[model samples]
Target: MRAFAAAAIGLTAAVALVLTVTAIGPPQDGTSPEPLLTTVPGPKK
Candidate 1:
């Protein structure tokens, strides 16, 4: 019974970690903070 309980807890933790990563998406390398920058200012219509 103890072994079975430990396995269940491990499985639950693994699943939780996977779900958390998926929801946040995979890590990105060399990603820029700003891809586009506008310098011009236009009058409001």
Candidate 2:
């Protein structure tokens, strides 16, 4: 009985997470104007 209850709770939480992400939708384009990392300079010869 305890195992069954735990399984049910886990399933409910998973479904809730999926729904929340779906409602939020995908991210918009150009959200970050600048790149995350800058170019590294070449090593001196």
Best by the TM-score measure: 2
As for model 1, its CA RMSD to the true structure in angstroms is 9.7
Per-residue lDDT of candidate 2, residues 13-35 (tens digit) = 99999999999998866377776
TM-score on alpha carbons, each prediction: 0.58, 0.62
| Clashes (N, CA, C under 3 Å) per candidate | 0, 0
1-45 in candidate 1: lDDT tens per residue? Answer: 999999999999999999999999967776778867567667889
Where does candidate 1 have its weakest 10-residue lDDT segment? 30-39
Give Cα-based local distance difference scores for all models: 0.89, 0.90
Pairs of colliding residues, candidate 1 = none
Cα error, residue 29 of model 2, in Å, equals 3.0
